[model samples]
Target: MKIERYLTNKMLLLTSIFAPINLAAQERPNIIYILTDQQTATAMSCVGNTDIHTPNIDRLAQSGILFKNAYCAAPLSGPSRAAMFTGHFSHEIGMPSNGIPMPEDLRGLSLGMLMKNAGYDCVYGGKWHVHTPSIPNQTFGFRKLYEHNDSGLAEACSAYLDNNPHFPFFLVASFDNPHNICEFARQQNLPFAEIPMADLADCPGLPLNYERNPYDADVICYEKSLNYSAYPTSHYTADDWRRYRNAYFRLVEHVDMEIGKIVDAIDRNNLWENSVIIFTSDHGDGVGAHHWNQKSALYEEVVNVPLIIVLPDKKHAGAELPQLVNNGVDFFASVCQWGGVDLPDGLCGVSYASLAESGDPGRTHQAYIVTETLFDKGGNTRGWMLRTQRYKYILYDKGRYREQLFDMCRDRGEMRNLAVEHKYQETLNKHRKLLYEWMNYHHVKQIRTEVHLIPGF
Candidate 1:
């Protein structure tokens, strides 16, 4: 009798010990990260752009938390994506521009590898710009599913979800669109531009900030304009710019339909109760903003992007967060936290999961978000921008018009410059100090100038 009692006791103890592990496995949600190329934050109808319709992406926002002020670490594709996947800055990962492979040392730090180590099946499809030769490759630790094009990518992801794997999965559906706007602008074949200007009265108008910043003329913005004639904005009339905007909106709508398919697959497979969905873009495109057609400048149109996170069981549904989130870094941190994976040391981001769950607008980790650009077509026109809730400060490494400050609360268009005003000197000084402190904390070695430091008052 005693022998049987002892065996029973052993079984009970074992079950008690393993019960938590089983519970944790059940709680760990499957992740679906949908990335779009060259999409700005305002492209969605949910965000108040009445001109375009993005029902699928708006559906995610309707059922999830939307970050209203999210910025990428870099303005370019490869570098921005590298920052997002690795939870590091572009400089930290040694990817400052397109057409560069992620450094060999940091390959193990990718989000796919981290999730894989946590026992989740990781899969990737479409438009992986971080790899060399600008093609989909397996070196980033994801199982390459469909590498052909966006349509095939959507089909492959849907088919995978339909199969219903046993284990938790992390699926990435990266689409290329609105990026097609670049080709449209380059080809100068805007359909409406080809039509009679009188018939195009229904097209969108130029951006509110279409006129360039008056104080900044010889900076990186001007240099890029002169160097990349492929954009050809100088030759465009007001009607052509409007047609360009119209074409860009159409491309955004095109990708929205592709996203709808993936979301449909998730719902069809009954994964909503145990899956977390994320939708964002690598960077934004200039939809005729400031007479610009492409990214790489630090304008709000290029730097700010759309970030939507849908948690399982509708946790914090329909919440809008205004905290400045560095999408490049915060994305990996949030995913790691959700997957119950231990993040490595020296990661430069904080997980906003707590804030998302509680729906608190006051919650913020860092006071300001900084974006950097080391090189563009203009060649080594390094620049840094510091964005706070109410103001923006920009400093370029090489330009006569090196400093620009705008009170973003008053001037959302960023048309006015306050850096040269005597009254705003204190505000400018505070932001400059903040930028320097951030750079020092991150151990940023390049573009450190005495001018960035605060003067003794």
Candidate 2:
């Protein structure tokens, strides 16, 4: 009888020891992270933009937490995506531009590696702009899905879902579309550019901030005309600008249709109830804001990106969060929190999982900084932009007019520069101090030597 009692106790102790692990495995949700290239926060109809229709993306927003003030760590692709995968700023990972490969020593910091370590089946498809020499779909411990283009990406993801993956999987479907608008601008191949003036009614109108700001800092002006400048945008007439906007909208609509395919697959497979979906962009395109065309600028059109998180039960559905979120950095930590994995130490991002799950307006960043340290005509000029709820401040390492400040509440278009206004000097000083403190905290140092411009920029 005593031996029997000892055996029973041993069984109970063993069960107790493994109970939490089993529960964690059962509770962990499958994660699907959908990333689109160069898409702005305002591209969706739900975001109050009447110029384009993105019903699929809007559906995600309606069924999740829509971040109204989310920005990328960097406005360029390689750096921005590197930041997203590693939960570190671009500079911290030695990726300050579009094509620079991530440092060899930090490759293990990728989200795929972390998730794979945590026992999730990690798969990736489409563009992997993280500068890893291996194909994007195959690198970072992610099983390859699709490698060609956006359509293939959607098809592959849909088929993967249909396979009924038994394990809690982490899937990433990266799409490239509206990014093609860059080619449209570069080749002056606006489908409607040559249309007769009488038939121009179908084209979209110029943006509210189409005309360049008179008080714009010199650094922005120079950068706008540098690497990605397509066909002197300053010379484009109102009709031409309208055609450019029309092409951009069409590209966005194309990607939206592709996204719909994946959404339909999710529904058909009945994964919606047990899955978490996160949708965002690496950065945003200019789409004619401030007379700019592509990214690598500090303007709202390039820096602000769409971020939506849909929990397993659609917790806090349709909630619009106005808190400042650094999507590039926060994405890693949030996935870790949801996947029941430990967040690595020294990551710069804080998980937004609680906020998405319960609509908890917990602690948020007081200010968010977007950094640029790429090569330009004058050399490697570094720029820093600080954004708070009510104000924006921009500073460049080298430029005639190196500072720009705007009252975001009063000037959403950023048409007026308030840096020199004595009345707002206190506000300017506060933001400056904040930027200085952030630089110090990050241990940022000036890159005096010129970096090689990314090929084909």
Q: Candidate 2, residues 236-316: lDDT per residue as tens digits?
A: 778877887887777888888888889999889877777889999988888888777777678888888999988776767
Candidate number of the best TM-score: 1
lDDT for 313 (candidate 1): 69
* Candidate number of the best lDDT: 1
Per-residue CA lDDT of candidate 1, range 1-457, in tens? 2435534553453233222222122578898999988899988999899878899999899889999989988888888888888888888766787777877777787888888888898888887887542334556768888773665678889999999774688888888777878768777543211223334677877788987887763665566665654466677888898888888888888888888999999888877778888999988987888887788778889888999988776667889988888888878877887788776777766566555766777764456788887656666677788999989888776666577898877887778889878999889888877776666666676534544432331
How does each model score on TM-score? 0.89, 0.87
In Å, residue 261's CA in model 2 sits off its true spot by: 0.5
- Candidate 2: pairs in clash: none
The segments of candidate 1 whose C-alpha lies over 4 angstroms from its true place after superposition are 1-25, 133-138, 188-199, 446-457
Single out the weakest 10-residue window by summed lDDT for candidate 2.
Answer: 448-457
User: lDDT of all the models against the reference?
Assistant: 0.77, 0.74
